[model samples]
Target: MNQQNVRNFSIIAHIDHGKSTLADKLILKTGALEQRVFKDQYLDNMDLERERGITIKAQTVRLPYRSQKGDAYTFNMIDTPGHVDFSYEVSRSLAACEGVLLLIDASQGIQAQTIANVNLAMAGNLTIIPVINKVDLPSADPDMVREQLEDILQIDSTEAILASAKQGIGVEEIMEAIVERIPPPEGDPDQPLKALLFDAWYDLYKGVMILVRVVDGHLKEGMTIQMMATGHTFEVEELGAFTPVPKRIDRLSAGEVGFVIAGIKKLDETKIGDTVTEFKNNCDKPLPGYKDVKPMVFSGLYPIDGDQYENLRDALKKLRLNDASFTYEPETSAALGFGFRCGFLGLLHMEIVRERLEREYNVDLLTTAPTVVFHLKPEHGDMVVIDNPSNLKKQDRTDTILEPYLRGTIIVPDEYVGVVMNLARDRRGIQLKMEYLTPKTVMLQYALPFSEIVFDFFDHLKSSTKGYASFDYEFLDFRASDLVKLDILFNGETVDALSMIVHRDKAYYRGRELVKKLKEQIPRQMFEVAIQASIGGKVIARESVKALRKNVLAKCYGGDITRKRKLLEKQKAGKKRMKQIGKVEIPQEAFLAVLRTDVK
Candidate 1:
């Protein structure tokens, strides 16, 4: 059978560029989804994805349809994460396909992320089919974006497809281009089973479901399969392609994309981008191309309700089953109680996962401000995971510690270029590359120490750019620099969670801002609560707010026994929520509230 009839393609675009919306239109046009009830970004199944108007994880769906010429083809439509944090996820998604439908917002033109997506597509050696989406918008400029892509990516602009994914316009042409341009899977069908596990999920009823792109032979129900990476084998029970909804099939053949539910039940067993084959008679060599996703940004995720620890653990396990990049482990804090130390691909990825856990699982969590992992060495030659800034006990020795650095890129309007450059220098960011996207926009590259840009950098960038700047970063190893551990003291007692690693030069400025933000977020207690940032015994900054000592007794409700007792009980519960810092019992919001702003 000829494989040319199949088209394996993924949609790539910047966040809010209508990539998800475009995917939905394709799903509707191909009859994969009902046309009458078709909604926007319908392929993003998670609640967080819908709420954020972004795709945090990659998803695949099969849209089987006939072309205008009456030629039948199976379009394995895939969607990728839009943020740079999930760059690895994007790469894996691209690897599983032969072509990408590059969706560019007609109004926004080409952003920083659009270029990143195009670079990944070129690296994968996939054919690029540029689509100018959101044509219905008043600011739509398809021709302008087409020229930009052509000049930047060096690809032909004449083939660009202009469409409004919202109204389902020009979707057919995009699909037709995929069929005409993307080369079909080219491998021997009779060879032993060799499939790539680009992504997988665990269903409550179906066990471990592995999403595989078959390269050779076929996978059938009841056939035993082996994961070469883990040396684990399981019997296939269910197999089918996701239609964005579950659709069961008896078997999946070579060059086809579908999921396999082997009696495998655990996530750790089925590795992402790993190889799978028929057990006993499996392929002699494992399938090529498998790379693990590395975590760039990390933070501690603690349960707000300490009693719900088990619920939190189960929630994380469930989340991990579907997401290979999200990692966590049980951890405890002297201040925030018990929680898990979670690792993420990036900040946005961390935010999406946290949001999903709260919304989908109904689990409320207290996430410690996001932190990047840093490499540190001591005189004893001990290696430690320095996740929290407070964990670092600063000594008089300067060369004893090493901190993380980030290779960052910022793309902004050309007018505010000087302001951004000055701000970067203030934050200890070193300029590396400057490229003119057009006469109006310039992309600035920087090599900044992670400690300098970890906090408030995102907000400062936007402020400098007047909201026209977008930034992305990757951790580029550790370097020794003048650094210090700044501690936050509440009511003369140091709050362990609020301490952070900062540069020695900017300690006073950071201390003041952090203390101020902490004071604002943390509510008053029975005794006066004083928020202070200190280096060793010296107080660098301080903010004090008097506590409400008479809150409970003053607001006494004179009622029947039931109502009166309930009021007392509520007061006691409220008191319990407050964490005692020195002489004051501060509310939990103080710890959580400071995370909302940039601490300025």
Candidate 2:
């Protein structure tokens, strides 16, 4: 195949804008999939992605297409994750292509991610062919969507195509547009090998399988490869490209996308952003590595059964092999026992990882409330980065504390603007600006503390907006904050996993609400269990769960109300002695029952 006949592109879009579906139609039209096996979202074969109707990972398929002009072309289309959590991942996928099909839902119009990704594509200097997907739906307004696209992106809307990916309309037109509009990858195949490793996964039989885009030179089977990032060399056991499935080839040349199989034992060694080339004939300088995806949130994952701690460790290890954005370290909580402190890209990333562990690894995990990493500087010592709240147990009062902040952009229906403003203010968000996208839709910008959004901001945003809002954010910088640690105690014993760092103004009320929720979740023990929320050793709120023996008024009636009150007073006085000797058995679920909240 000639390099001139090759076209590399990626499908960029907001969530559920028909990226995977369009990819499916293109693959089928190209005859990459036989009619007997064609299916929607065939590239999103994972059970989780199929069930959720979203693409969680980046995937690529090689298609051999013949243009209407009768010229054969080799098309490599990369499918990228659509959520904000994986925006950086999407960038890596886009980096593999010379251009992209900017897919948008015609009915939903342009979204937050659509705006962000358009900027990203411009930054990369990639050609963008706007695509209006879901045109088959009755609600689709191609003309309106086109106007919005031109207004927001300043792109000529006349070039945008209207199509229904699900109904297989405009498949040929899009394919032809890709070949005619997108330029072929530019690089000399004779140069020293330099392939950008964009994605990877762990394989039980083959070890690490790295997905790469060959920008220059060639990679073939049984060759020694060097990872520029890790400075490690490996003997390639296999080399191939995806025809929606791995297909062995003699070699992957420049302007091609494929996989390099080697005996990679540790995933960190084959980092996604690294450049892979021949060990002996390596290029003098590796390709510019990608901007690593920094984790925006942190949490603790403790096993429901203490004995499964090792299993949980193995599960995380496996999950990280495929997901480069996740990071973790060994951490311990007095209340939850042995567990690991994990970092995630966002709340959705945290949820997906938790779900995967439970469904795929078959291990029940109790995740502590999510938090953003905090910077703590002592009065006379080096600064420290803390992710777990329990680490603040020994911090100094005079030390300066800094919290991460983010610039959040939200697009919402105009009707929900009031509720959104309230939510933003409650979360310590400062309005930066507001603008109307359409008469029925508006966009807002805010400077919000990352800690506030890390926990469950998206959930609340959707809740307040009636699920008619889309949000995206970028890290601004860390700034000084008046923050304090809120601790929860059961029977006067501190529960480390239940501790969290919050702003001073919110501590008292948040503490009060926390203990109340815990009181409902924590089961009564052999003796009366007293739950307290405190900060700096001062208890702010308290709740008590009486023991079985305290229920002496089981036969209470309206006529016996006075007697019931007397018994309750007696039980309360007697609880003083019982509380001193009682140990509250907080159930596993109690450790995370109310973690759904954005704060402690």
Candidate 1 residue spans exceeding 4 A from truth = 379-385, 396-398, 547-584, 593-600
Give lDDT per model, in order. Answer: 0.79, 0.86
Q: State the lDDT of candidate 1 residue by residue for 210-300, as single tens digits.
A: 8999988888899998999999989888888888677998877778889887878776787777888999778978766656566656678
Please state the error at residue 175 of candidate 1 in Å: 1.7
- Please give the distance, in angstroms, between residue 320's alpha carbon in candidate 2 and its true position after superposition: 1.5
Q: How displaced is residue 493 in candidate 1, in Å?
A: 3.3
Displacement of residue 219 (Cα, Å) in model 2 is 1.1
Model 1 residue 255 distance off true place after TM-score fit, in angstroms? 1.6
Top candidate, metric TM-score: 2
- Evaluated at residue 255, the lDDT of candidate 1 is 80
TM value for model 1 = 0.89
Residue 316: error of model 1 in Å? 1.7
| Per-candidate count of clashing residue pairs (backbone under 3 Å) | 1, 0
Report how far residue 109 has shifted in candidate 2, in Å: 0.8
